[model samples]
Target: MKKAITKRLATIILAFMILTLCLNYVLQVHNARNDMYLDAKNKFWQINQILKQNEKETEQVKEDLKANCLIRAKAAAYILQYRPEITEDQEEMEKIARLLQVDEFHLFDKEGTLYAGSEPKYFGLNFTSGEQMQFFLPMLKDRELELCQDITPNTAEQKLMQYAAVWREDGEGIVQIGLEPDRVLESMKKNELSYIFSLVTADSGTTIYAIDPGTYQILGCTDGELAGKSITDVGVDPGTKMNQGFSARVNGEDSYCVFTDGDSVILGITESNRGLYKDVNSNCLLTAVYLVLISIIMIVSISKYMDYYVVRGISSVNQRLEKITKGNLDTKVEVETTPEFKELSGRINLMVDSLLDTTNKLTKILEAARVPIGVYEYNKDMKRVMATGRVADILMLTEEEARELLLDHVLFEKKLEDIRLHPVTGGKDVYRLPGEREHFIRMNTFSNANSILGIIIDVTEDMVEKQHIEKERDIDLLTGLYSRRAFYRKMEELFKAPEELGHAVILMADADNLKKVNDDYGHENGDRYLQGIAVILRSCKAEKQVLARISGDEFVVFLYQCRDREVLSAHIRELLLTMKGSTVELSNSKEIPVRFSVGCAYYPEDGRDYRELLSLSDHNMYQSKRNRER
Candidate 1:
């Protein structure tokens, strides 16, 4: 029988081990595929962002080229209107070039022959002659049209140049205007495309390549040898239509790749899926070997467990249970061979003693608890059966009086009605007795068998102290307004919401000449001046506004969700007038006028950032003070 049990246990364990190995293999492969797919998706998104940025930059460059071309064309037209008769007048032409802000000027006939140019070396070079033929041939065909070319090498100097041309307004010939390369380099210096498409090679042999769409050349690649090579050389056709994460063979290796079409470049990310999943297969094999070793160990262990101890130990435990069931609470098993069985017997003996001890301890704990606790049974009327631990002291009554009051059903119902609209058995409720009490009682009620038990504690002083501490932290003692930290925190919350900030305005003010007042009168007079300014700010009474004394001599105001900008401006104008007329009387019966340099910045119009808006307001305040001084 024992051998049969051991064989059954081994079969069950072996089946579980097989299931575990299969599940682990599936999960690992699934997770690996998921990770690879997410990585590819992220790379694709990055490529899209880079392409968008490139488009924006290219558009800006086009705008600059158009503006430069227009300026050069207008200059050429002006020079044509006033001709100097000498075709090769180098001194006159160079002067015109400097006035036009161009590197050189070329005058060409309708047949594309250069007549005069700023550079003496190109006095007779024909536009249709040599390297400039392909670009200038079009100008010869359309003599009246104005044109501008992208960067090209200057024939005379062999330096990069940008040129624009327009027909002489009299239709006599074409005049060409050239811009030096230095003027175009600033707009053309962005390398965001190369930075975005740099190669990323994963440990699993995944490789990324950046390809130029115009030349089909590899711009950047994980494979060093492939750089500067054509995509076709690496077996990828630039014109091939492919979806994202398409499975195909790349470079004669099984892989997955995707193409991201950009403004001037094509981005490709490829992964060798076969190389990535090989580790998952190896892990499965390793796990199977471990399971085999563990199965052998457990099978041997189960054989020993069943043969020597399991059967006899279970029989002894059954006998001990029968003795304990027959009113023998002290019964203990002594003939246990294995440690598991010996502990099992010891636990059974301790369980009975624990039950008896728990009952005695519960009674003692109830009587000794400092907080009052009570139990009441309900039938037609409620009766308090037990009360303990300062119940009479908290109730301010004798024990007999407390019991009599608790037994009154109508009085209990009234108290419950005052404390709770809907009574929940386990929820806490606070109740105050009919008196000017120093403490408030907190009670938790629950139903137990046929009775209700309540545990109560007094927690009055804690609530009062928490409120007092919070007030001290949030309020500024000197000005009776919000503290600087509190004002900043509130502003931060407003900045996170765009709509809230849109209707708000920030006001920053500085007390003008506070140092003069302190030096002439005293520091006490300076304090009085600051206090008087605070009073003027507090008298505004605008709803939903926050005023704070943010610095020693500076105050800030946040006017939130104003109804009208003009009304707010008008109100500020009135406040400034009031400030000019207002005076603070000193202890020596001398009156001093209050003046402030005030500035205001509107949110979503001046700035969306809190620090930026504050700085702007402060700058405006200083500007106002400077203007007044002037």
Candidate 2:
């Protein structure tokens, strides 16, 4: 092509300006719409990251549920050791099942025979009955043993259950509890296709959809209106290779679309292309007229002013538009020499802003909805910490501390080590700040020689709730006594004191007629019998005496630091005298006397261990009962 020389320099400049605007507008329209599909791909990647995180979270939640199962098993064992009335009471055990949030609750005797449970049909089942039952055989032998099973089908009903078992601390029997995995099932729901769609963040006009690979029907869609519609119904060609970007008539409008490779789910992204180029198309006629007018005016004004001011402003505006078309949207047409040029610059800037504001909007959405964690980088080469968003908040650092931590290499290394464990709770790989208030943090790091990247998560709410729940679990609600767990904890702390610890005594008591009271009256009246004894013992309780109902018909007392054996005996005699006339008020308004057999074994005198002393006292009480019967 031959270059045409303009008779006037103004016409030559006018032609160049016209050519620049046309090319700028064309590139802006083509590239801006293509970006929508790219965004879809990135959004899909983000969704995959979220699902992967959910998988890890699901495993953690399952582990927590298992620990909960163990705690519940221990609780059941505690009740059986202390509440004898429910030993063979199927109705009572069923009530306990509800209270413990369990589907099945069972108790096994020393011989590994299941004598009782919430379900009466399972009574008389033995450890040798099935593999599921046999799992507890070790618990029968090792009284300190604890065991839990994975999600598996139960022996009889074949229902999927998670079971945990613990041997009674008193060496009586095994207590077990089962759950149906409701929490785990709920967590598994996050893996669904519909759930993945919910997590996706996409462009304003873009519609993300999951289609059945066989039927090509929409399984799930971000655009609610397109749900249940087939690809053909949306004006998309079923035979088209959708991974490549193409123009199509989607829902009566021209759109740019890209789809993933087909699988059980085929994901596709579609965004209207018409509106993206509407500004360029609508301004074409105006631009043509402006070009003609500019030629006429430039031919008239041929002075140095026109060459310097007019040409310079036009060139500057063209440069900005070039940058804008190349995706530098922040570039503004700021030429301001002449009124006409200034007004033109302002309108062009506004046009660019209107066309690319979706980028700005999407950026804002991501920044605002970001969650508790933030990406943190440990630049090993620089020995500096680099973080974005709320990493400082997750790390519980102030602006000053965060700056210092980033600046000081030794501090950064120490901070890394500090976060590797909980200081107060001794939990590995958990970060904790224990002070007037406690903060829990969790972070996982991946690294190369150059840097370490971490995802810092705040887990204070979970840790705090666990601590609170444990406090609530340490006491028996019915008797207002220390729960079996609390009782043992207290006893252990005392026993752990120095060896110079003075003489103590262990007293074991059994409700001699508790079973008869339940049979003659009701379990309600039987509870009253236990309560009556509890009140009597509490009234006789002196300083340093730890009392707890160890099982349905059993109670234990720890008398700490007695002055002498005579004093301990006198205290026991006083307790027996106090309980002599204690009575339970029955539902019939009848008052019945509470009769119980009591025995005592001195600490260091009877045996060295609490369990051994308990066994000796228990034998002595039963022996006295046998002698009295004779």
Candidate 3:
């Protein structure tokens, strides 16, 4: 009976081992294939995202160019309207040229003849030969307000022709203002690659402009030689025929050429797919090795027990042991064995049973103990926050002092506002807990019909460490004020607030002749001068205002709740005078007075918002410097 039992146990162990090996092999193969497929899919998605981002950037560049063109056109129109007498004057032409930053500025008569221009050669000349003339004559006849046409003056000279109608006080004949194409396209081409750009005439199948420098072997054309060929004539599949604006390969190995115009297509061919399998293969090998090691460990552990313990034990005892392993603690081993072995096995079984019962009890206790949890309440639309925990807390507080203290905290409203999105549960928030300085406060959000849950955890240490790192990041080592990056970030946040109703006054002040100061004072004194200026600006600003030393000698102050333009101007002048009184003592024991150029701009009056206001303020500051030089 013992031998038969031993044979039966051995056969069972052998069969189990074989089954485990087979299952492990199948699982590993499946996992490897799945990983490879997922890796490929991720790579494909990454490429798609990159392409989308590039496309977005390109569109933005185009929009910027269009906006710039409109501005230049409007400026030209303004010059002609306000200064009609200077329309035929050379000095006035130079002024307009300088103001517009154009190479050439021209005034055309009703008869398509140039009346006055920056170029002496164009004076008293007719512009009726090139493609620009073809686009210009029709506009003059139709009395068009503005027109942008592309023209190739010669085989080597291609220009963008911008012309806007200039109506005089009487509104009789059109005075056309023209700018060179190079001035507009120059800056754009410097940043955006022109090789991927193609200009095609909309009505005709004519390639007006093509910048592809490489030979198109697939289309049987050489560089600079594919200008006149029809897009369909090339090997590229017609996007119009496919009824899609853009198309890419299914394998994502290649991107399809884009037909931006009816007449031409722009092909942006990317690099070849090499080393594509490297990451997938590496991951597969590593995972396979890990699985094999784990399987070996599991097999050895199972084999050891089967040979030395379970096989030698009686059938009833072995059955009880299996039940115990499966978490059945009620079943007790009945067969008697040697005293030492029996004691050891019996103790282990009892201990496991006790642990199981204790685990269940603890789980129930934890479930019951969970309390004081709150969730965000949203309106019917679910996008806007109707009420939150912080709001509820404020309402609950009968005393105004208690509410005021909590409201004064930096993250008070922001934390609650963030919870409105129910982002904490989705791994969005990192906060610090009260009274637990070392611990961090973490919250996870859960949502149902009426409210959203914020599962809060203590995360104090994390918040403190993060604040320390942020302070280190924002503070400049040299001047000890906020760095340029910090200033920009703060400005972005300030301007982004929709509730900011007050007129924002921005003052840009720069130390006069900083380079000369640096050269004469050996940089050490220059450093002192910069620090002195930073201190003056910081001291001059009110408590609510933001002061930042943006550059080596430049300081930016954002006056949040200033009275009016005149009041803000007076404040700036006063600050400048105050700065003038302050002095920096150099190494030579000589006092150097601070000199600065101040320029200010107001929101909604000087410009629309922060970006435009900053630009206008910067322009005004430079203008002030120029005036001082004069």
Query: What Cα-based lDDT does every candidate model obtain?
Result: 0.72, 0.77, 0.56
The clash count for each model shown is 0, 9, 13
Candidate closest to the true structure, highest lDDT: 2
Instruction: lDDT for model 1, please.
Output: 0.72
| Residue 340 accuracy (lDDT) in model 2 | 88
lDDT of 1 by residue, 189-256 (tens): 44544455452234547777778778888887767678889877766656667445566677788776
Please identify model 2 stretches exceeding 4 Å from their true place. 1-7, 82-85, 90-103, 110-113, 124-145, 152-160, 170-172, 199-205, 211-218, 223-243, 249-253, 261-265, 282-301, 304-630
Clashing pairs in 2: 81-550, 81-551, 82-550, 82-551, 82-552, 83-551, 83-552, 84-552, 84-553
Q: Using TM-score, give the best candidate's number.
A: 2
Candidate 3 or 1, higher lDDT: 1
Better of 1 and 2 by lDDT: 2
Arrange candidates, best lDDT first.
Answer: 2, 1, 3
After TM-score superposition, the amount by which residue 101's alpha carbon in candidate 2 deviates from its true location, in angstroms, is 4.5
- Candidate 1: regions farther than 4 A off: 53-195, 199-204, 210-221, 224-241, 244-247, 258-266, 304-630
